[model samples]
Target chain A: MIKGSLTLDPKIIRQDFPIFQQAVAKPLVYLDSAATSQRPSKVIDAEMEYYQKYNSNVHRGVYRISVEATEAYERAREKVARFINARSPKEIIFVRSTTEAINLISQTWGRTNIQTGDNVLLTEMEHHSNIVPWMMLCKEKGASLRYLEVDDDGFLSLDQLDSSLDNRSKLLAFTHASNVLGTINPAKEMIRRAHDKGALVVLDSAQTTPHMTTDVRDLDCDFMAFSGHKMLGPTGIGILYAREEILDRMEPFLYGGDMIKEVHKDSARWNDLPWKFEAGTPNIAGAIGLGAAIDYINGLGIDQIRAHERAITSRALDMVQSIPGITVYGPKDPDKRAGLISFNIKGVHAHDTASILDTHNVCIRAGHHCAQPLMEKLGVPATTRASFYVYNNNEDIDMLIHGIEAVKGVFKL
Target chain B: MSEDLYKEIILDYYKNPRNYGTLENPDMKAMDTNPLCGDELEMQIKLGESDKIADIRFNGKGCAISMASASILTEMVQGKKIEDARQFNKEELLGAMGTPNLGPVRIKCALLPLKVLKLAIYSHLGKVLEGDDRNL
Candidate 1:
């Protein structure tokens, strides 16, 4: 691992991303990093190097280059495990995406452990990825699905979780941070409480992994999942961190060639922890890119990135609140959030607001953010979301504010 | 990316919508949602004995394009037949908006009202217009 304390002066970070160097449609104000992050040259070049110099199928080849390729692939897995502070590289299962990773855990663990009378505890602020799988699992198993509600500021009510964490609770899954509200849940505490009730906990870190330093070992959750695309890596690659013992107890998600020790006409023996979860040819380039992304994030440091986002979010909260008729959602304190901000303007539709912002070359997400239950709690069908990343700066926030002002002017509301 | 598409008239309708409230004893009612943006529109139609639309009312939340499109569409289809009203789709709305290159997002916004209108037609008349989904 590279040794360095984090320091983020936005000017220096912007140099790493080539997308910021060009002229933009409006002014290239990108605030949708929570959905997906912009890749740095280092991550891009890493993928290119793999295809250009060391292109081979890993684990099955005996040639010199194949060995090198296999080493790199395993090293990537190790890096992923290190990034999340998992106990072992074997615990890190590479899947197509966070959605797929959650589906894997749900199909394997949910199908096996959770019974008809069991309960799976989820949160209202969970993205559709985390909620839908458990819902499907509960429906199929004749189990009950429970949700932890949030306060008006989108704060997860841990006190409310006290009554819900009962003997029937077999699985507890939730997001580390909300994609829309940016509310960072008390993941460690939640994990502890769920464990107290003898339930497995899965943390969806798709929003948290990019902006915060994560140590799954310290969190001590049963499983955690995050997408590569949301952390400056290529799409179609994600990591599923399952505790080794838990994985050993769980069944394989898919059945195919690479995932089997030996196959008979009627039955097959599953290979191992990580491979059993990954059953296909896999996104080879994407894994390499994700490894490079871990390198990039580690180089910059997640603490520095988090600090930078805090500064920017503070500025954004001030700016958006300063505007009359503007209403901000989520917690008021920056420390309570990750790197996203959602808001609404009186008498303005979120799509209209987003369209006007797009005219100014500002990119923000405007919709339910796949958290329909949270949207209902917020009392709006949709809201404009401005998510930040390492590449974002004060100027980007200013541009977002300017874009909102322009929208207000055009609408004159 | 087209600010011109969100004309003053559109915002006027959004701020002080024409048919803001519900209708009493409505003849036809339809609700449509732009799943992408989460905009929901519930439109109610009042038809005359002559098989022509006498009045139209809508209640929902959406962007300027959808709100404006709904405002303009209700006006356009007030005295027209269900078939003729179905003909007024995104192309006519874009022509009304006077934009050359409208993106899919804006197109979605513009087509929200039309979708509700179509749903109303389908529910009332039992026939979905051809190629309505592809209009955007």
Candidate 2:
């Protein structure tokens, strides 16, 4: 079901990242990788290499430098395409972020395909990015938006999903891995079920691509969106991966210079598959940095990263639960989660817990995490989340435990 | 906020919030919520002779800064003239709490109670709450 079952030493991985060197306090234990990861020196150097060597506009100029720049840019796209196991590079379209990628599909394919009686399916645990766009599209098209319920243990019911999907269920969009609940939804099974009902699946892989391998062919999702920033690449670049057949049919999301074939005053012919959706000057440096990030992950082995996180998370779950008055959300099994934990200490608000942790120089996120409906379901205003990555180890877990102890001390609980 | 100040002042007021309750059919009352972090606050006050603040209480579930600030604000204004309590400001409130540095977002947590109390007073007097909330 997953890859890279080997273990790795995070200490060596820490040496490649420069931010770990400069600590504001004694130890800067970062437990917020789910928000955005700390970039490695290699990823940073790759962006600098692009600017220093071949900084020219892509596909427009005929000079040598222009040719090199275009190759670097398109090569990055090809790297992303291969990384996700897409059939062709043309299936991968570069966008601003996962939010923009979802909007592109909603604007083009959803606008045309979903009719007045059509229904779009979503889950209770979707991030605002997944929910809001479809809501806007469904409202505009006179189509209804429905949801599959999340159970008390934080898993979506497949039995309910089976009953809900029908001929009118035109599209089903859901998160591949929940950022807050830490639930890794069974994407392959969900896609298979949706396909059986003649409903297309849009997999939001923003939280999964970093922690696990994403094989588009294996899952058979019609569309997928994920960000580079969360996966240790630079911001301003993200991937919108749709199947070749669907991407070939959708119109351009943005229209500009690079996306056009031949233009007249009256009309213009659109460019090829990926370029048709990508408008204007692309994030050349950002794409190059993303390619470098992929290379680095490949070097370290994503499966090793996954196995290491599971080891750390297994230890963390037991450690966190040992403390009295602790309530951990999501599945109890480590295999069911990604690399994060969202929890709360009894009688203490998450805000107070986080600030107290800050005093101990242990960084964690404390808020609704943009999943307000999930918060309402959990009966919590917010949660204190500790997300691990390839750089995190047992020592950082100690810091997290120490910070949580400080919260207990300050509250005298 | 300073760790020392946080341990001493804020935690005390938060754990044992003074004047933390609701008054039945209160003379003046207002409630507000900070949508950013879901910090909620409700302040109820009863006036006496010359519209002096005779009784005051607050009720909410929030972070240390917000809860502590509400506790201190209630104690500081319980017997004062409504006019004087209405003139109370963030600087005075912070000063009374020993002036811990609540960073950008936490500062709003501290001001939530102050805003709700001001609105309660302002609404009873047929006046709108004044001053920028962040500044306050």
**Per-candidate alpha-carbon RMSD to the true structure:** 3.0, 3.0
In order, candidate lDDTs are 0.85, 0.89
| Candidate 1 TM-score to native | 0.95
Q: What DockQ class does candidate 2 belong to?
A: medium
Q: In angstroms, how far off is B110's CA in candidate 2? A: 1.0
Candidate 1 regions exceeding 4 Å error are A1-7, A23-27, B132-136
Candidate 2 backbone collisions, by pair: A4-A303
Measured against the true two-chain complex, the DockQ scores of the candidates, in the order shown, are 0.81, 0.56
What are the per-residue Cα lDDT tens digits for candidate 1 across A1-413?
A: 11132247767888888888887554478899988899999889988998999998877889987888878888889999888888789999999899999999999888888898989999999999999999999999999999898888788887888789889999899999999888999999989988988888999999988889899989998889999999999998998998999899888888887888889889889987678777867777888889999999999888888987887787789889999999999899999988788999987888888888887888899999999998998889899999988877777887888888898888775
Error of 2 at A266 (Å): 3.0
Per-residue lDDT over B32-96 for candidate 1, one digit per residue giving the tens place of the 0 to 100 score = 78889888899998888677888899988877777777887787788998768767666776676
Pairs of colliding residues, candidate 1: none
The CAPRI category of model 1 is high
